[model samples]
Structure formats: structure tokens, C-alpha cells
Target chain A: MNTEIQEASDILKVIESANKLKGAEEPSGVLRGAQNAWDLLSDEQSQKHITTGSGDLNSILGGGIHCKEVTEIGGVPGVGKTQLGIQLAINVQIPVEYGGLGGKAVYIDTEGSFMVERVYQIAEGCISDIMEYFPYRHDKASSGREHLQPERFLADIYYFRVCSYTEQIAVINYLEKFLGEHKDVRIIIIDSVTFHFRQDFDDLALRTRVLSGLSLKLMKLSKTYNVALSLSWIWRYRCSNKLEVFVWLFFNDRLNTKDMQERRNIFVGDDRFCVLCNISASEDHDHLFWPCPFRRSCWSSIGIQLGSHSDLNTLISGVKDTASAGLFSEKLL
Target chain B: MRPPAPKPPLATSTYNQQEPRPEKPLLLLASSRAAKLSLGCPLLDRFLSGGLPAASVTEIAGESAAGKTQLCLQLALLAPLSPLSSSSLFLYSDLPFPLRRLRLLAPKSRPDLLDHVLVAAVHSPSDLLSLLSRAQHHLAHPSRSPNRLPIRLILLDSIASLFRSDFDASPADLKRRSGLFFKISAKLKELAYRHQCVVVVTNQVVDVVEGNTGNTVAWSSGRQVSPALGLAWANCVNTRLFLTREVDGNGGSVKRHMKVVFAPHLPERTCEFVIRRTGVFGVEPAQRSNNSSEVKAHGYYLESDRTRKGGSNQHKQCTHTSI
Candidate 1:
């Protein structure tokens, strides 16, 4: 825990070839250096969230996202994360009169991806929803004073297009003051947070530290301001990892097999190997176990009565039905 | 005077060019109009505490087409008004410099000041290193123009472009690439301090690690991708500014805000401005300068929503002019 002891230990690790720290000693007392964990808890704590209007997302997130916490959404390209972002920005503008948080939004588009036309469409949908529920009491509202134009809700939201990570970090750090001045503003969204950091990172450790500092600022702003901070990160297919790989793994197998003559490929059918036999074949889901020679041998070797069935589901039930006491008995294993 | 005072310490001096050189740099008097670089944008000048400070590197970072080069063009046009001669160095590192925009922003009178500006394209980090030398050599011996014009400002529009595209930094080569950038920064700092000219470097941004940076590091605060070029280059910077753009209405007119991210003398404040045909101009938030029907120039900074409640002082003399 002591400063000198920590440095000594770090150097010892580096000397022993257990760790690799680039700089001998990191320059201490940089901007917003490491703080006591208790310092953050000293501030007021509240778990309030403005409804995003979409019931499914709100429910999935346990009664909408926490305004006091930062939510980072990452996905492959063309995932419609920006669409969801724009919808949330528009949805956050529901006035207090209509069972909604009367709050404004700030959308920071780093990659020039924020579309005004899309925001307009979403804003119009929100206005119609508001009008349907909280219908104007005055019959001659049009002639009277009340006017609901699409621009009204759109005006409350502010958008910032940032090119560099410095600007991205700057706008985020300065957002505290912006939020304070514009008290009504309650949401901040950045489309594709990793757009700039993908290419040139001259110093990895330094970039991590700087990124760590900026990340701290975003969370601090969200908590202090009690506003939702949502940012989306996009990755291409070639560099797919994390969520992309997770999704791809489950969805990679195809259900239907198309015509082999039309498609320009050497393998006739699916060109997949059955896990049972470990041999290549024109494989689909049904052929993986049943109907195939490898699967027939696997079924016969186990002494489970194999029968003719139209599909895999019926075949599964056929085995289950015939194996009454046999299910309880141990197999060849 | 005083034989140019021995070129004090690579850019740390606030000597205000008083040590003297070939061309007598303007006296950095508080009252003199030439003391500050105008930047042609009044709100920017006011926010910047009388424009960019001399003998320091000011980074104007933003996204592509965030009016960085536009601001650079404005600075080049107003370079003549700086403490020294009208000349400047515009190094296009990413893409070709927009000559049409430069010509448009150039002052009709003293069009030759445009000629005083030297333009060069940087291919790589090594290329940039050589270009820096060529700039110094050219400044030392004038051959292009009739009269010697000491460059008072150096604009490297998006300095990260070439570095990002060319260099690939693995753990083995990280030291080499960073050392190269450090050398470049040292030279730039020397250029800035010795000549007492402004060095405005533009850098592109990147995304913070999504699930990566947060869990590994000590982020009780949160996570974000730090700006590009890392701390190696960040250590040498004097002032860092960020430009963020946002559209006001369906009309698609963007409102740009300039934030002083880090600087010894400047506060971290963001001021809103609009880009017009002439150049970038500051706009009052209440007025929404781009939109006139909702707001009139006559109105003050009163909330539009409060107009229905308060009848008193419905009309007042405008204290500020926007755009």
C-alpha cells in the first residue's frame, strides 16, 4: 500500500520478467489522477432513469437504464445501434404532462453519423403519441395558443459532432457545465465510440490511461447530472470479437440448403462435418445425427432403437418413447 | 537588438519576441491591436483570452470537416495581424488543402499575404520530419518572395493523419515510433519558441475500448478512449482545444462549440459559434443564430418558455450582437 513499496515491487516484477511496464515510472499527478474510491461515494447517490419509450428495452434493462450509470453498447457494423440511439433521444423528450420525464437530450455524433431527418421522423412519432394520450383540452387549440410542431422537442436536444478522441474527451469533460447551464438536458449519446482509436495508437499504455481518465469523466457526469449516458461502439466483421463472436458462434449454422448447381462452390451441399463421425459431408441439422451413416452407427452402437421419422424432432421423441426402462439403464459406456 | 538573446530554451520563453531577430516582431503590448492573433472570430478571440498565446503549441482537434481547416484558413488570413509578419506555414498532413476555401476566406486587399503562406503535403512521420527541416531552411533563406516574411504561425492541419495511416506500432516498434514523434514534437516546440510563432496542430480522435479498457484499468470514474498520439505527444502540448458540431433544426445548419480542454492560462469552457460564408462566428445560445423566426436579434437571453408567464420586460434592448 505504501508508495515506495509499490514502486519497488513493480520494478522487481519487471526485473524478474513477470511484468512488462513500458515506462520506468509513470509521471504522477497528471490530470484527475487516481482518487480514493470513497470520494465518488461521498457524492449524492440516486438511481433514476428516464423511460426510453420502448417497453422491451426498458424491461430487459430492469426498468430502463440507470441515469446515474454509464451504458456502453457495442455491436458489428449496421446493427442499427444509432437508430436505437436516435429513438432514445426523441423518446427522452416526453413532457411531464404525458407520463414522461420532461427532459432534453444531447447526442454527440463522432463519425458524422447523426441524421437530422431520422431525428425528425422519430420526433414526429413521439409528438403523435403525446397528442393521442394527452389530447389538448381546448377544442380550438390550433386557433388558440397551443401549437405542437415537430421542432419543439427537437430543439431541446443538442448534438455535437466530434472528430478526434481529444474532442470526444473534451466534450464529455465539459458536458458537466453544459448540462448545468441547460438543466433540462438529461441524455448524452455518442455514436461509435471507437471510430478514431482503431488506427494509430503510438503508445498503448498512455492511451489506456487517457482513455481511463475520459471514461471516469463520463461516469462522473452521468452520476452528478443524473442523466443517461449511452455510447455505441461498432466493429467490422474481420476484427469481430467479444459480442460479435458470441453471436456468430450460435448463428453460424444454416438451416436450409440451396441448390448446389447454381452456387459456385465445390462442395455439393452444406459442406459441414458431422461431430459424431468427424467426416466431411453435405450436412444439415437433421443429417448430423440421424439418417447419416455415421449417426446410424453411433445410434446402433448405443443399442437405442432407431426408427424412420420425417424430421429430427420426431426421431428424438421416438427414441424417448421406446427407451422406457432402458433410459434408466447404463449404455455401452 | 541584443543579438537575438541566444534563442532562449526551446519554446518556454514569454519573451514576446523582445529579444529581437531579422524582422522586428511587433511589441507584445497589452493595448496594441497587433498583440493578439485576431483569428477573425470575435467570440473565439474573447474565449481564448485574446487569441492563441505566442510561443506555444495550440491543438485544435475535431472530426473531419469540423471546421478545423476552416479555422486554420481564417488564421492564415489574419496572420498579417499577428505580432510579426503576415507569413505562415500550412502543412496539409491528411488531405490536400482546400485552395478554393483559402482563396474565398483570403482578404481581397493584401491578396499577396496569401502568397506569403507556404503550403506542403506530408507523406509520413519521417516525411514530416524532413518537411519541418525544409520549413526551417526556407525560413532561414528566403527565395520565393521579394520581401522576407517571417512565418508567425504554423498550421499542421490534422497532424495525426499521416502518422495514423503510415505507422503500425507493435510492442517491439512502439519505442521507435514514439521516439520519432517525440523528436518531431521537440523540433516543433523549438520552432514555436525560437521564432515566437503559433503552432496549431490538429489531431483526429479514436474510440475508447468497449469492454477492454474499463475492466482492466482503475476506472472508478468510467472508461473512454483517450485522444490519439497518446501521452508522448500530449506532454509537449501547451493548449488543447476541441471543436464539436451539432445541427440546430431541420434546416441542417450546424452550431459548432469550441472547448478549451487543457491549458495553463485558459479555463475549460465551450463557446458556441456558427460557420458562415465569411468565416466562423459566435452565436448566443438563446438566440439560436441560425434560426431567426423563433428568435429575433432584438430579443435578449430570456427563456422562450418563460414568455407566457412573465409579461413585464417582454421587450428589451439587445445587449449582444450574434453573428
Candidate 2:
């Protein structure tokens, strides 16, 4: 084998040895070490909770979102990302075993899309079957009586709106405080994280910095509260009518290189970046994943294989199907 | 020294003052185990695990005129009057049908079924969300016995219509539309858990791009691909059944063909059903003789060849039945 393979093999051996050592430690010592680590990681005890969403989706996400991690869902317009997030929040408030966390959800709507009517629709959809099997009991009996009501289930969801990035941060902070006081909030949904940050930060560096901060904050909240933090991302499109021969030439030059270097290392100066102008537009989730040439290029840089059906809706459906079937073993790529 | 021992003899009373406890009756024993009711459609019930598992979401999607609303109406009428003693409720939002039509469709339905069905005409996505929350609130603490059958079913006919842009305007408005739907789905899941009711949502299908055809016919071919919500909505649902039209050689009329396109535990296959005046009926063909196919293929020898020509309408109908 070549030196690279040899070196990789050596590293693997070292990792295996380390794992063996970790496994061989005295049980008491390992327990003590685990306790110490847990103590150091928290100022207060963290409560782990799950959101009561669809069983398939929850199972695929490893039993709902993990606390202290920002699950970013990016899709073109009308892919149902926001709707899924809202449903997650509501589901979190339900008791476990019924596919819910039995805790409250904090919904932060950055784009002012939260609505109450759809909640009823969801409830209606959920109970349509039960009603079919057992009709209202009052009609068959001599005793005048009634059963079943909807108010108890609606009490679990809490909604909020954030107009700016700062406001979004404030909401997270407030959620942390609220969680501390009442350890029942298990899910946090922020609809459309792109709207606030995209408008204010034009420079790439500045945008990355802002996004990094926001992601860090969301991560911290997730871990600290043991709540799943789900955020939605809006997709942007660029349409180009004119074809430039230089674009293909530049790409070919990069492809001809012997060594595949990191993308960051290739940028020698700010002016070296490729430029393409004037693009048309259409809005849909498929555009965000595969159809959009710009996004496809970006994703390719990160080593993600874009599938033909890479739209947000298709992905969600695929995941849900797998999750429900108890076959969703792959991690989020 | 002494343990003296003269213990006084206890006096034995012959009369028992306490009355004998009566044996507990076993009259209600069988009724307790019969709590769960069946939907009567075995295949559909199997998809729902014997019946819709109480307190869960079951989503149903199909193209336009795909019987989604019709099934919802049928379930609404059938659910509340189940053989099981559990109580039920049906909540509908943004349905196109009038109350009178629903009443006519379910003439045999119990009057209480009508009352249990909470119908709301939602004009916007936001309003639909509010209706879900309200229904949940009512289901949790009905004015009846808490231990009795609680609100059992929630039916959302064509959830996609609520997200259509024609109902709203502006990016802000679209966001609100989708956000509201998200929240509603979440709440319904919760309600399903608390009440052990099943949640069913009907969805509409939009055209989506199929593949790179490279065809360039103006007005129809340049950009022939359509758009759909795609993965996002699919991910949220636990089960998804796609209903479509299937050809029936017996008659030219349309028949409902349901396929378990995406489900956690169910096999992916299609089943056929017909819509009747009462409700959806699963059609099973009668047993046929081996020669029936040959007779059908030949369209039966002409009557003139055997006995007579120009058979009467009644005779034709009888022959058709025989075939």
C-alpha cells in the first residue's frame, strides 16, 4: 500500500487501541469519571425530552431533535418546512408513548407566518379515524351525555414573532430563562432564519460570522435546555441568460489539478472569485437542493451528492418513510 | 418463680354482627375488553393497525377528485357510531361541501354525529391553525365523563389548499400560511396522544418536474416541470397513502384505487374500491366457472346461431349478469 494508506491504517490502529483502553478501565473508575464529566458539563441538571411529532420523522431524527443542536431545514418556498416545525412544537407538548414529549414548544416566527387555523386542521386530521370507529355516545343511550373535546390539546403550544436577528436572539434567551423556570419546554422552532440575517449582512465574511454566532447560540440553548432547536432557511435563486465560455474554462482548469486541494486554500485573493451576473428566478423547494445551479455547485464543494429528487419535500418524505419503517439509520448528511 | 398462669378464658360470641358481603357482578367484564371499534374495512383497518391507533396522526394524500373528501365524510359518519362505546368527534376545516350536502350524504347517521362534527370554514391558513388549537382544547376536556371515549378522530380535508398562494399574498403572508400549518400539525399530534384519537389529513398533489427532457416546444415544453412541496410535508407524516384512478373494464365509471405508497410498516401496493350512495365499498368479484372467460372473449355466440335474434332488454340484462 502507499504511504497515505499506511498512515491512515496506523491512525486507525491507534484509535482502536484507545477504544480498547477506554473499555478496559475499572468499572468504578469509569463511573467516577463519567460523574465528574457530567458535573463539569452542567450548572444545573439538564432534562432530555422528545417532541411528539409523527413517529416516522421522530424515529429518523433519533427520537426527535437532540438538545443543544440547531437542526437547520433549508428549502425553497412552499416546501412545508415551517409547517413541519410548528407541528413539532405542538407534538412536543404531548405525553410520551403517544409519540409526544408532553412538554411545551416555543415557536419563534421570524416572517410573521404563524397562524391558529391550521392547528385546528392538524387536530382534525389526527382524530378523523377515531371518530369513525366510535360515534358520539349520547345518541345510542337513554342517558343524555357527551364526551370528547379539543381544548385540552391546544393548551400545549406557545407562539412568538421575531422581526430581526436581535429579536430572534432575545427570544432564545427568553426561552432559556423560561425553560429554567419551567422545565417543560422541549422544542424550539424558528421559522425562516435567513430573512433577518440575509438582509443585514452583505459581505460573505460578515454573513458567515453572523450565522456562526446565531448557530452557536442555538446550539447552546439546545444543550443547556436539552430541547431540540429547529430552524427554517429560505432559498435564494440567481438566473443567468448568457453563457460564458470562461466559466467552463475556469472549471476545467480546476479539474485538471493533480492534487485536490481544499476549497479555502485555492482562493489567492478577493478578486480571484468567479463572477456571473443576471439570473432569472423561480421559487420552490426542488430549486434549493438540485435544480438551482448555484446551490448545486455550493453543495458539491462540500461533498454532498445531490439526488435527482433532492427537493425539501422529497427529502422529508423519504426520511419520514424510512423512519416510520424503522429503517432510518443514516445520519443527517 | 413462677409463671403463673391462669389466663382467663375468652368468651366466644355465637352471633356474627357484620353482614355478609355480596359477590361482585361480572356483568361489565366483557364490555371492558370491547372498547376498541373496527372501521369494518379490513385492509384499511390493517393499514391503521386494527383500527386507527388512538392518539396518532394518519395522513392521506391524493390528486383532485380523488375521494379524499368523500372518505372524510364517510369516516365522520361512521366513527362516532362505532360498536365500541368510545365517544368520537370530527373536526373539519376549509371543506368545500355544504352542511346540507353532508347531511344528505349521511342520512342514516345519528343526529349526535352531526353535533360532534365541528365544522369551520377557514378562509386563510392562519385561521385553520386557530381551528386546530380550538379543537384540541375541546377534545381534552369535554363536558362528559373523562374516562369515556374522548374525541377520537380529526379530519382535515385537503390540507394543501390552505397553503396555496391564491389565498394569501406577499412573502410574509406565505410564511404565515406555512407556519400556521406547521403549528397545527404539531398540535394535532399532541391531541392524538392525550385523547388516543387518530388524526387524518387529506392532501392535494401539485405538478412536479419529472426529468431533464431537453424538449423545447414553446408554451408547453421549454419549462414543463412543475413544483411540489416535496420532502418537507412527507417527512412530517407517519403514513402516506396515494389514491389514484384505475381502469375498470366492467364499466367506464371511475373507481378509487388506493396505494400504500409510503408507510412505516405497510407494504406498498394498490387496492380497489368503488364509491356508492352509502360510502366506499370494497368490490369482490363472484366466483366464475372456467368457461366464463371463453364466453366473455367470444362475446357469447349470437342468439340467431342457436335459437333467436334480437333478445329483449330484460334477457340482455340477465345474460350480462350471467357473464
Which candidate should be chosen as best, given lDDT against the real structure? Answer: 1
Question: Candidate 2: which stretches are off by over 4 Å?
Answer: A1-333, B1-37, B83-89, B93-101, B104-112, B145-149, B165-176, B209-229, B247-251, B284-323
Q: Over the stretch B292-318, how does candidate 1's per-residue lDDT look in tens digits?
A: 754653254333433211221121111
Per-residue CA lDDT of model 2 for B1-323, tens digit only, reads 11132222111111111211111112211332233345556545533334444434566666666677777776776666775434444445455555675686666635665655656676665676567667667765676754445567777776776576564557665554444444555556556544556677887665544552321111111122221334445444555666665444667667666766543223344566667766665543222235777656434433232221122222222211110
Instruction: Give candidate 1 regions above 4 Å deviation.
Output: A1-333, B1-35, B141-146, B211-226, B248-251, B285-323
TM-score of predicted chain B versus true chain B for each candidate: 0.72, 0.63
After aligning candidate 2 to the native by TM-score, how far in Å is the CA of A238 from where it should be? 45
Over A129-199, each residue of candidate 2 has an lDDT whose tens digit, in order, gives 22443355334642322212223334555656443344454455456556666677677777777655443
The TM-score that candidate 2 achieves is 0.39
